[model samples]
Target chain A: MALTRRDILVGGVGLAGLTVSGCAGSPTTGGRPIPVQGATAPPGSPNLLVIFSDDHRADHLGITGEVPFLQTPALDTLASEGVRFDRAYVTTALCSPSRATLLTGQYASRHGVQNNLSAWTPGTPSFFDSLAAAGYRCAYIGKWHMPGDLPDLPGVERFVTFTIEEGQGVYRDCPLIVDGVQTPRPGTYVSTDLTDYALQWLEETDDGRPFCLVVAHKAVHHEFEPPDDLLGTYDDVAIDLPDEAFTYQTLLDRNVWEGTAGRLQTSYRRYCETLLGMDREIGRLLDAIEPVADNTVVVYTSDNGYSWGEHVLTGKRWAYDDNIKVPFIVRWPDGVTAPGTVSDAPVLNADIAPTLLDIAGVPIPAAMQGRSIAPLLRGEAIEWRDEVFYEYFADFPYQVPPSQAVRTDQWLYVEYDRGLAPELYDTVADPQQQVNLADDPAYAATRQELSQRLADLRREFT
Target chain B: MSAAAQSGAGAMPGEAARSGPVGSSSGRAWRIAAPAVISVVTFLAIDLLLAALVGRPWGPAYPLSMDALVLLRMGPVFFSGLIVWPVMRARGATRAQAVVGILATPLAFAIVSGWRAAAFFPPLEAAYYSTNPMVVGAIGSQVSSAGVGALVYALWRARRHRSGRPVSSGATPLPISTGWSWGPIVAIIAGTALTVFAVIWDGGQHLFYPWVLLYGSLFG
Candidate 1:
């Protein structure tokens, strides 16, 4: 195909237009991407404020119309200012694996640390360390579930840690020890105590320095006990049962921990009550950062998703949608595209690190398995990954065999070693994942393709 | 057959008697054989297996004979598979329930067993009873074994009543309540009691019958 005179003339004009615009005002990318509607902090510098929650779900929010009794005005404010990732997800569903992947920009298998049994050791080159080295002051508050042995970190000025309930620590009314002294309950609650400490840190911290503050909360983990103040708030409001809540239809063949509807409903109600408390606490933390809102980037996310009895399974060990997907929101008023636009780009916990590095103008390590979310931030056409891999190794009580999965937006392929079989679900059609299509004749092609991809992923990561 | 001939409890008359002189009961002696010896041996083997496989996992603190789950494990198989719905008539349990029961019971048993395995076997309702996986087997493994032994005694009673033609008519068989059972119960009690002394003497529960009781059920 030969270039005509008209085609050459048109190309010349377009190229000439870009050249002229580069010299004027703030030179933004011309034809490569749609100009982001929100403010872009000139070049690469922005305050990072990551507000992470545990076991919180996107659909559980009051704005989502599912959990109306809940109050999350701060998270709501962040979403109002920036894009709420309507379908963001954690690579793995368990706690440590999820956080490890987020920090290292790699899946749990590559990192070789799966559940709460193994701690995420320092010297592992977390993005936090990279940000600190790049001259950003960092502070991590709230539950450091990874490992409590905080090694000397250069840039992190504040660190708070607590083990979850049942891990040799009491959760609700128990006194929390900070720096080796058992701090008496300021009042009659543990959740408020932690929040007060975090809020105090925010107010007392030295200012004028670019900072990255991560506030991780343990509101909704287990034995769902809220502070006395928030205890009866959602009691009057009838808790909306998660769609798969009370599945009394026991498969007559498969044997498991036998539980009754009274157990499931009672637990689900308590789970929501705990979430409601966390939602209120989030509002408190947001009010803490309201003064520096312009320069700050607030991201609200959870470690992993939890299940409410879908497919007769009651917990978070499996790689089903209910357990793997979590809420991810990025609200940097100065950065991020589409003041309120949502994208279907698949994001991993690993990408959280590089995305921060990209926002902070820190170079992403070549060894990192995650690609930065920066391109998506600029509204550029990013060749984002099509599928994400996930896995979990055994932890004491959850001593199930290791499992691996490949999840596309539409399809999820998994293998449960217990059944010694592979399962495939087209989440597009069956979000409930009632039917397993791995053995279906029609899905042989799709399964084969996904299987190959899963194999390739394991090999590359291994 | 007359009551005397049918009993099979006596010997035949002396050689001086005519060919068919014994009061006729007919040739009905072939209908029976004593199942007592086999029953007790089977009983011992099952208990040993239960103790070895299920009992040891709970730990060495428990002696083999006192595991309550041994009863639970056998009761369901007995009531459902035999008595209530005889194996021939009753619906058996599914494979999954069996696996869960088999797998978890051993853990539960071992835990219960170990709490005092070194101290010897305690009754199911002892101080540690509430802490262990309670037998809820109403009458669990040990009692089930006792029941088997009692059935044997009943058979021995019926077997001894013969009176004619080498099988007697005068001797009366014993009642089920008359069997030599307290000995076995006391033997188990003694074994458990001795286990405490043994552990204290040797400083370990793993010393006694490591091969026969503990290792056999776990591996074999």
Candidate 2:
């Protein structure tokens, strides 16, 4: 059989054949059925598309609770069909590092990546590498925040990149670093252009092969701008005032609105408007995939939660739920036997790697810190990893005192090594965490237990 | 460089379908390169706009001049790092087709250099370490004292880059037919030596010496 450059160049046609013909069907070469995965027909292996939003809070979702007029029908459809974890968290609450955690399935500290600034060059293997090793053609389509001398990803094909480099505001026609050359997308909004590229890949690439496509959305992030078409979609929804946001203003008398750092500059109205485009974009995306959605498993979650009038902080990197909790919903109509089961149990963002591999029927590596949640999806009884740890390294420069905590079934213990006063809250008793239990003598045993556990977790993290 | 920023991120859309104003009858041939060129122009326009916005918040431009020179200075380091991937790729590197599959660095460095060099130099420091004013002051004062000296080493890199050529394809190593293989390498080494030796007359210098010269010339 002759292999021509034309076969490879067929991708130049945009709809290249993904099927690798089997030797079993060969007329001349009589061989036993040498089976293949993505060679032909429908992809025997499932496709995984993880849509990660940067600095987006879980509560902002319309389906999560009462929200200002926010439309996320596509995401809502995902929640209705897949197992939506109510409590999902990032190890480090920064952009690049959190992204690293998702790739590495390890905490930022463990991965040797602490913050967005400076070099966090990866020596560890990313989940994409593992997927590639398992014969999946992986691709990252948007929002690559991994800073400084990015590792040459072996198996992962980065078709496009929205830089996480500083001062490169996440806005329209933002310089997209593609194949290493910093170029631009032809559109008014960067998100729209990114989605366009994403859909193009979907339409063009042969879906027969198992693929890991990550579409990291830049909208619902800073200097918020929604497309003009969807600006009126949520213009009337009454915004729910979060408890942490209004009360925390007292702590910032010294640094009121003048608060300057790497904090997300967002307003209630602006954030709502910015998210409108994402909601509709999400809707449109689901519409495109809904036709042949059986084989595809779409995982929707944010890199880290953002504060919109929450804690008056205006960004991530707090022990508060507003910062850590992300909306995690996985939709696999054919894959999951039980589709609409909601799991309130704590799930770590790190779990994403193992879970994906489990669903793909690939073996989870021992090096990965995350455990698979495939059982939860299949409604199988499984032992859960209780007491998930939380971490927040200062994103705004010069702010030391890294924040760390451990959240169990009932308790939320936070230790602030940075100058902020440490606090403990009974999430079960006071859902809002309105009362501080760190100083109360009545809560001594709980405090001691939490403190020791937090210490032990720290030791484990190191 | 600042002119690029004025375009903003949302410079235009549908550049693919709409042909830009072509002056010559050779428009048909030029149209073939149009999509690639249009995409690049749109992306750079956004980058420039973002850069401009950043400049407003930070400065006029985040110059890569000295840093480019520094990277050029650390050509050995960057190239050395490049080997890890090439070797790893040769071995069991799982991901076969990376965006920066060896050829990206040169292209990226060239783009960063051609656009942001000179003006974007002296990468933001005073604003970065705003933990305490002392850290800020220390960095600012350091910038003041160091000035062009901060970039002398990076400046020396300009001569080296002038000698090299672009690797046209992502698959192959850049051909070395145009660059001064031995002569310019030695000349650069000598030139760097003389500059450092001159700085030593005052005191030992840091990396910012070249940038300090720029500041001095501007002020004087």
Q: What is the DockQ of candidate 2?
A: 0.02
Chain A alone, model 2, TM-score? 0.83
lDDT per residue for candidate 2 within B1-220, as digits (tens), equals 2211333332222221122343455553343333323333443454444333321212222222212322232232123222322222222222232212222332433344333322212223212222122222222222222222213322322333455521111111222233223322343354444444432222222322333333334422
List residue ranges in candidate 2 displaced over 4 A.
A1-43, A164-169, A232-237, A242-266, A398-400, A418-421, B1-220
TM-score values for chain B across all models: 0.22, 0.21
Over A6-85, each residue of candidate 1 has an lDDT whose tens digit, in order, gives 43333221122111112333321111111112222233357787777777755666566655566666567667778766
Model 1 CAPRI rating: incorrect
Distance (Å) between predicted and true CA of A212, model 2? Answer: 1.1
lDDT of 1 by residue, B1-220 (tens): 4333443434121111222334334321111111222223343455556435431224443322332434434343222211211110101223232223222332343443344332322333123332222222212333333334334433443454331123222211223334344533542354344433333232222232232233224322
For each candidate, give its TM-score against the true structure: 0.61, 0.60
Docking class of 2: incorrect
Minimum summed lDDT over a 10-residue window in model 2 chain B is located at B165-174
| A1-462 per-residue lDDT for model 2 (tens digits) | 111234323322222221111311122211111112332323466778888887778877777754746666767777888888887877777777788878777888777667655445644677676676666766776776665554445556544664433322456756555444445444447666666556555665643456678888886765566786655555565555543233222112112212222222224556667776776666655655554567778888888886554434556677777778888888877666777777887888888888888877777878778778777777777888788898876443222346889888778889875245668889899866667898999998999999899999889875
The residue-level lDDT of candidate 2 at A368 comes to 78
lDDT of each: 0.53, 0.55
* DockQ (Cα-based) for each candidate: 0.02, 0.02
